[model samples]
Target: MNGSDQTERPDGTAAILSTIGEVAYRWTREGDRLEWGGDALALFGIASAEAIATGHAFDTLLDDASPLARHDSLLIGADHGGGVPYQIEYALRPSGPRGPVLWIEDTGRWYADGGETARRAEGVMRVINERHAREQRLAFLSGYDDVTGLYNRSALLDILDQTICDAKERDVNAAFLLVAIDDFRLINDAYGYRAGDRVLAAVARRIRGRLRDGDIMGRFSGHKLGLVLMGCDENEMAFAAERFLAAVRDDVVATADGTVSITISVGGVAVPHDAGNREEAMERVQESLGVARDSGRGRFVGYSPSPERDAQRQTNITLSQQLIGALSEQRLRLAFQPVVDIHSRETVFHESLLRLAQPDGSIASAGQIVPLAERLGLSRLFDLAVLDRVLETLARHPDARLSLNVAPETAAGADWLAKFAKTVSQRPDIGSRLIVEITETSAIRNLDETAYFVSTVHDLGARLAIDDFGAGFTSFRNLRALRIDMVKIDGSFIATLPTSPDDQIFVRRLVELAQDLGIETVAEWVQDEETVALLSSWGVNRIQGHLSGAATLSPPWK
Candidate 1:
C-alpha cells in the first residue's frame, strides 16, 4: 500500500485489478504464487488456490477422469511458458458440469523477467498519455482564438482552403465574404478601449447567432473584421453581408460605461471555381473592401477590379520613393506661422510646419506634404524629420521659439517615442523651444499609446498640445489624461466666431477649462483680421493661420 498501490498499479507491477466475472477481487501474477489472482481458481472448481499448484486436494479438477481436470492442463499449457498474453480461440471447460464450456476473454499477462519489464511498460504508458494530452491541447489552440474562443485567422484560412477544395472536387459552387469594421477607430475613441473590445465580442456573438450551422466567422484583423461565406453565390453573399450588419446594429455590448452598439462595413468576393488559389480570392475580397471604404462608411461592396484604382495605387508607390529621396537629400524644409501672445500682441513661438522642396525649387505646403506622407506609412519619418529640422534651426537661432506640427498617425504608431528620444538626445537645448502638436482625430483612436508617448516626451524637456481640439468625441477626457502643455481651438470653432455667438461661447468655455487646468491655448485657422481680433478678445493666448500671412521661413515668422 505504498505510492505504487495508490497509483493503480499493484506490487509496483500490473495495474490494480477491479471487478471482473461478477465477483470482486484483486488480481495479480507472481512467479511463486502463479494463481494469487484467485478468481481463476474459483472458476476452475479448485478446492484451494494453493492446491491448484500442488496437485493434491484439487487433483480431481486436473485428473484424467475429470474433463475439468483436462481443462486445467489446457489452461496451464496455453498459459505457463506458452505466454500469459497468448490468444486462443479454443474451448474453455467450466466447473460443476452445468456451466457449459465457455469461450472466455483469456486476457492477462505472465512475466518471465519478473516485474522489471512491467515497470518499464508502465513508464512507457505514462509518457504516451502525456504526449497525447499535449497534442490535444495544441490541436485545440490551432483552431481556436485564445482571446474569445472563436476560430483564429489561421483556422479561418484552413477552413476556406478545405471548403474550396471540397467544392471543386464535387463540382459545386462556393464563395467567401470578408467583412471589415469601417469605423472601429471612432467607436474606440468615443468609448473606452475596454468598451471597444466588448463591442467586438458582442459583434462576434451576434454574427454567430445569425449564421447557419456550417458558416464560419472570426475577427480577420485588428479593427478590421471578416467573415467566410461558403457554398453561396455573389447574390447570396451580398444578402448575408446585409444580414450581418443588421445583426450587429441590433446587438448591444454591455460594459462598465453602459450598453453600446456599433456597425460594420462588408467587402466580399465569390471564389471562382477556376481561380488560381486562396491568395487570389483574398485579393478579390480586399479590393472590394477598399471600394466600400471609399464609397462611404457602413456599407458593403462586391468585388470588381478597376484599372484606374490600380493605377492610382501605383502612383502612390512612385510618390513614396520620390519623397524618400527628398527626405535624404535635404530637399525638405519647414515653413513657420507665428503664435502671437494675445494681450501683448507679440509673437512667442513660431510653429515649424513641414514643406517639401521640389527639384524645381517649389515648396509644397504642410497640407500637401503631410497628408501624402501619412497615407504612405511615412508619417513617423516625416514627423521625425520636422523635429530634427526644428532642433537644428533652434541651435543657430537661440532667440527663436519653436512649435512643430505632427501628423496624428505619427503619434498613434509604435515608432513614435523611439524616434522622439533619438532626436531629443541630439539636441538638449531644443527641448524648451519645441512644442509637439497633435490633432484630435489621431489621438482619439490610440489614446493610451498617445498618453504614454506625450508623457514621455514632455518629461524629456518638450511640450505636447492637442491641435483641432473639441472636434472629436473623447477630446475632453484625453486632454485631462494627457495633461498637455497647450490646446489649439479647432478653426471650425473660430470660423463662425465672428458672427455665431454659440461658436464664441464654446471658445470661451474652452479657454476657461484651459485656465483651470493651467494649460495654454491657441486659435488655429485665423483667416481674416476680424477672426484674429475676435480670438484675441476671447482670450486665446496665440493665433496661427493665413492671417499670420501665408507661411514664411526666411525671417522664420514673416
Candidate 2:
C-alpha cells in the first residue's frame, strides 16, 4: 500500500491517540517507506510529517546509543504462521540538533510473505521519557548516595575489597583512610538536618576535588567518608590524610542558614601491610580515626600496631568466633533470676540472662560476652537467639513468665520486633507471658525510637520494662514518653540501700516517682531483710538480687 492509503484511520481514534502522545506508523519493507496515521509532527517534534516519511529518513532520528536499530529489532525476528509480535524501547533525538532526547516505547506486529521475509509492519510509538528517566535515576542511586553524589557504603566496601586484592597481586602498597567530620552532630543540632546535608555535600565536593584520579571516595556512613589511595604507603597515607583535612578545614561551608566552619579527623592504614583484607583495614582505620579524634580535632593518625591493642584485637577475634560457634551449636544458654514481689514476696517473673557453655564444661557470663558482641555488631544475633529460646521455653511451660534484656542496637531497630511478631503469630498466647527489657541507657539514647518499641511490644500483647533504670537517670519526661510497664532500679543503688543514706534517699524518691507515673519499680541487688524492709516501706513493687535468687541454667518452673 502507498503512504497515503495507510494513513487513513477513524477521526476520533486518531485524535485520542495523538492527544496522549502516541503515533501509529506503517512501514513498507519493499520501498523502505514509512507512513504516519496520527499527529507524527507533534510526537516527533518535527516541522512536518514528511521529515519522517521514509524508513531511512526516520533512522537518522534514532539516538546513536539506542540499543538496536528499529529495522534490526523488528524485521530480523523469525516469522510465525501468524504475525510475529515485538516490543522495544529506544531514545530518539527528533528535534533540531542539540535538542533534548525523547524516549519512546514501540510495539507492534510484522507480517511476512511466503518467502518468510518481512514485507510490512504496523506499530504504535508512545513517549516514555518520564519512565525512562525514573529507571535511570533508580539505577544511579543503587550505587551512589543521592545526598553527596558519592558511592554509597556498600559500593565503597566492594571497591575496598577489590582494591585490597589488586594491591596484593601487584605487590604494591596502597592506603585506606576513614575521614570523620568532627562534632557533626552539633551541626545538625544548630542548623536543620537539611543544612547538615548541605555541609556533607560541600565537604564531599571539597574532598573529591583534592583526590587523585586513581583514588576513590565514598560516603562510608553518616558524617564519614572513606577513601582508597593507590600506590601509597603509610607515610604517603599520612600526607594524603593531611591534604584531605585541609581541604575540609581551610574554608567554611555555606548552607542556607549560615556559614559553618568544620574540621575533620582522619585515620589511615597501609593496605596489604597493616591490613590483609577489607574488614581488617576498616577496623584498623577506625581505630586510627579514634586516635586522631582523641588527640584533638583536625588531625590525622596513621595506624600503628601496638602489642597491647594487637593482643586485645586477637582476643576479640577469638571471642567473636567462639560466640558465633556457640550460637550455631546451640550452646548459648539462658539463666533465670527471679524478681519477687516486695509485699507478697511471691515470684513476679524470672529475668532471663544469657550464658555461654564452653566446650570444656565451663560457663561464661553475659558480662563477658555481651559487651564484646555489642562492639562487634553481633548483638542482633544474640537478641534473635535469646528470643527464640525464650519463646520455646514459654511454649513448653504454659504458665511461666520471663523477662529478657536486649542490646541497645536491638532496642533501636525493628529486626527483633519482626522476629517476635513471626513467632507470636504461631503461639499468640505466649506474648502476654513475655516481658522485653531494654537498659535505661539504651532506652534513653533515642527516646522516640524506644517509645515506639515499647508501644509495639505492648501492641503485640507483651510488656516492656526499662532495665538498670536508675543508672541512666532517665528524666520524668522521657519515662512518661516510654510508657513502659516496669522499671528495674539499677543494682548500684540497691546494693547499698541499707547502709548509704544517699542511696536510701535516691531509691525512695525514684520509687515514689515511678509510683506517681503508674509504673512498677523493682529494686535490684537486695542482699538483706533490712534493705527489703526499706524498699518495701518505699513502695517498691519488686526486688531481684541475692535476697530473691541468683540466675540458674535450670528452668525454675520445672
Q: Which candidate number maximizes lDDT?
A: 2
TM-score each candidate: 0.61, 0.66
Predicted candidate 2 versus true structure: per-residue lDDT over 282-353, tens digit per residue: 999999999999999899999998999789878889888988999999998999999998888899899999
* Cand. 1 TM to true fold: 0.61
Give the Å shift of residue 352 in candidate 2. 2.3
lDDT of 1 by residue, 1-558 (tens): 121122233453323332323111222233212223314444444454455442223333322333443223323322233344422222333354454443332333333333333211001111122444576678988887755568878877777777777777887666677776657777788887776777777677777888876777866667555566667777687788888888877666676766766767778877664344678777878878888888886788887667897799899999999999999998888777788776675788888778888999888888888778878889888887876677778777878788777776667665656765776688777677778888877777777878877888787788888888878745465688887888888888887778998988788888888878888888888777787777666667888777665578675622
**Cα RMSDs, all models:** 11.1, 7.1
Q: lDDT of each structure?
A: 0.67, 0.88
Global local distance difference test of model 2: 0.88
Q: Give every collision pair in model 2.
A: none
